[model samples]
Target: MKPPIAPYAFIAPALLLLLAFGVLPVVVALLVSVTDLDLAGLADWANVGFVGLENYRELLADHGFWQALANTGIYAVFGVPAVVVASLAVALLLNRSENRFFRALRAFYFVPAVTAIVAVSLVWGYLYNTRFGLLNHLLSLVGLPPAQWLGDSVLVKFSVALVAVWRGTGLNIIIFLAALKGIPREYLEAAALDGASELRKITSIVLPLLRFAILFVTVTTVIAWLQLFDEPYVLTKGGPLGRSTSISLFLYQEGFAAGRFGYAGAGTLVLFLVIAGATLVQMRARRFDADH
Candidate 1:
């Protein structure tokens, strides 16, 4: 039997886009990573010299790289779970009602995700301002001193991650809501008839059924956090003694700021591997849990 031509025709454009934007960049980065390609190399290909794994070796020893890696890990550790739980909770609440008000509320919640990152960061920047800010004004009402949200090294990680988490949850809430809608109403009715509490129904039935959605959200959330960039870039500028400098930011600094493209490419490849490994581990754990 011949396969339908219509499906392939529909997918052809997307496949071409992925190959050009996604696959091609990775391949070029891989090639660049093996050479000592700097700003000069960009203008003259003859200046490029292959350095083998030297770039990787230097990256491994660089304290800045390690700090950036650690910062990214911290962001993921705090941001991923927060986004998942907050989005799921919001979805569960919103899913309870389908009225006009609730429908409008869903759109309101998703505003952060669609808004420009610069605009969101600017709003948050004011909120995090040390003085003459809404947050500080609120604290002054209680006779408390103003806290340095983005200025303190220790507090900067959470400050930056919080913005990302707030921005990230909007989309995930929609995903969870979609998954929640797919769940059969019969299961809830049966549980209700059996004298199960709302909490009981959710824990034993709703959550169990939402495992696939939960897994999908978790893996993607982890990947997003690992590549943390925009919020930190715009908010703190990876400042306060580089405490908020994520791996992605570090690569940006090296590649463009310092004109060390090859070194940055090596770091890019490492970051890619870390993302791939983390995703695989999550998926395998989910599979294992399902089997058990």
Candidate 2:
């Protein structure tokens, strides 16, 4: 039997693009990670000397790196569940109606996902402003003290993660809505005949049927939160004593700002491993639940 040439030809362009953009960069970064690559090395390849595991060792010892890792963890922990639950909830609400107004509301919910992060940050910046922002102004009207949303160290992580959660929920809501639509209407109709309440039908039948969708959304949301960067970068710049600095932002600062390409490459590799490991764990857990 011969392999199908047509199938390979069909996928070849996509495969080539992935190799060039995705796989090639990681390979180059891995190679660069073992060398003392910096600004000087960029100008002259001869300046890049082999320094096996040196950057990794330094990264392991660096307090800033550890703090960034912790901050990234915090962001993921806060954002992932919030995004998943909010997206799922919104999707369920949207799924309830096929009305034109509900359809319009679906698009409205998705606007944040398609909007540019820079623009979203600018709008959120005004909302977080202490002196004249709407949020603080509203607080004053309610006889509550105004909060320093982005300036307070403890509040900054949640503040940054909240923006990301808001932006993130939009796409996941669409994903969940699609999944919700795929569910057979007959199942719910039958459940209603059996005297099942809406909540009961959702808890018993709908939820189990939607397990695969939930897992998909959860895994992707987790990966996205793990790579948290944009919201914090635009809003906080990882300020308030680096409280909002994610590992990605930390790597950006190291690689671009400080001109430590090799060091940042090591961090990048570690982040890749973390994301892969987390994904694998989630997959395995889902499989285990499916089997038993």
Candidate 3:
């Protein structure tokens, strides 16, 4: 009895912290979403009135809300695959050589993973400048016309996606590098002895073994892209006709910037549901694959 009680006591502090930080905030947000909380409400508690799903309904009808949701989907759909593929490619390239230079190169490649988004945005902001940017200057050197990287509607979407891919792939690349290293030499040697080509071995053996890492990168990249706030906020400010406005940015604009706290909470809940649904679907798919 003493032993069991002591084990529970040891974990109680962690449980209390979780309740205070995680559970409490979410519960409070849920309550706020159903009420007409705003700047006025912040001034006077009596000003806050229960609206009960009215905010949610308003969000469903708002065109800006829908467009932001769609824009977020564009990032998740486009950026996640690009990040996964590029990370895997770079990981595979660097995996071939275990030399000191390549090891240093791998370390360099991971710089963007830990770098602050604010810093990346500042650097890329200059890189995407219309007339004087390095990227456009190089394009002009090749006789191609310089294009607006962040101002044009269509290009801005892909520009931000490219920035996301650039900044987001470093961590996944390391994950894939580790995954590739973990593959047994015996399997590749066995394939070589059987006269299997490099491509065949990769397609048949390497990829199958790296499935978990691929799924992990895919799921997490998608989730991160869905929450794309910092990049667009810093670079485009979700501008050029608001073509690049993301759900998270939209929430920020509504809640903190606009002082529509209830409206913001509703949008927050919507994004939360989207993320939760994606996670559940991925879990189900993974379980199904495992079962099969």
Candidate 4:
């Protein structure tokens, strides 16, 4: 009796929390996705009605949905690679030096990751301002035109991606550094004995060992960028004709601003599906890469 009761007592709190928070919300959202839960519904629960997949069908026909999806894809395609490369490079550079200054730099780089998103977004917004911004000021010093980093269609996504990359690189750097530390010194020594150059040793030894870290970072980055909201929301409100509007922002506006809760729920479900599918593909690709 003590053994059985003790096991249940120990796991009961965790199970309760998981059911109350995780399982409950997912079930509620799934139900909401199939119904017409709107501002009216919020005011009076009786106002809600089952709409089935109407919201999803509406999403299929919505031009804004496709546009947001395309924008997110573009961001992930470019930003993920940039982040992976930058993180790996920085980790490699830092791995060579265990000095106190370099240790401090690691902490400094990771500061953005732990910082509040809204605070970071506000700072980046000021930096991206059209006039009297630090970025424009630097451009002036170089005799370059003061480009609208967040206002222009072509630059808005890139600017948002830059902020995300800045925030994310630190995390990936830590991950890559750990991966780097695990590499056997004998591998490097053997490569050196075989007359391998620095680049060759990295390509042949370091990268192969870091593949798991790379895959993990890339997958996580893709998922995060797909649901991007805060940076663009604070900076431009998905503005300049919605060029910076991501799926997350679209869903946010649909639910909160437009009171289209059902529509937003459908969008949320779609985004989840997309993330799930992408993760599966990435896992498969990584396994294939490892095999060969």
Using TM-score as the measure, the top candidate is 2
TM-score winner between 3 and 4, please give it: 3
Model 4, runs deviating above 4 Å: 1-23
Q: In candidate 2, what are the lDDT values of residues 1-292, reduced to their tens digit?
A: 9987999999999999999998998898899899999998899998789999999999999999999999999998888999999998999999999999999999999999999999999899999999999989999999999999999999999989889989999989999888888999999999999999999999998889889999999999999988988988999889988888999999999999999999999999999999999999999999999899
Ranking by TM-score: 2, 1, 3, 4
Runs in model 1 lying further than 4 Å from the true structure: 1-6
Per-residue C-alpha lDDT of model 3 across residues 200-276, encoded as one tens digit per residue = 99899999999999989888887888889988898998988889999999999999999999999888888888998
How much lDDT does each candidate structure score?
Answer: 0.95, 0.93, 0.91, 0.89
| Candidate 1: pairs in clash | none
The TM-score, computed over Cα atoms with residue i paired to residue i, of candidate 1 is: 0.97
Candidate 2 — worst ten consecutive residues by lDDT sum?
A: 236-245
RMSD of 2: 1.0
Q: Give the distance in Å from residue 46's predicted Cα in candidate 4 to where it truly belongs.
A: 2.0
Q: What is the C-alpha lDDT profile of model 1 across 14-126, one tens digit per residue? A: 99999999899999999999999999999999999999999999999999999999999999999999999999999999999999999999999999999999899889988
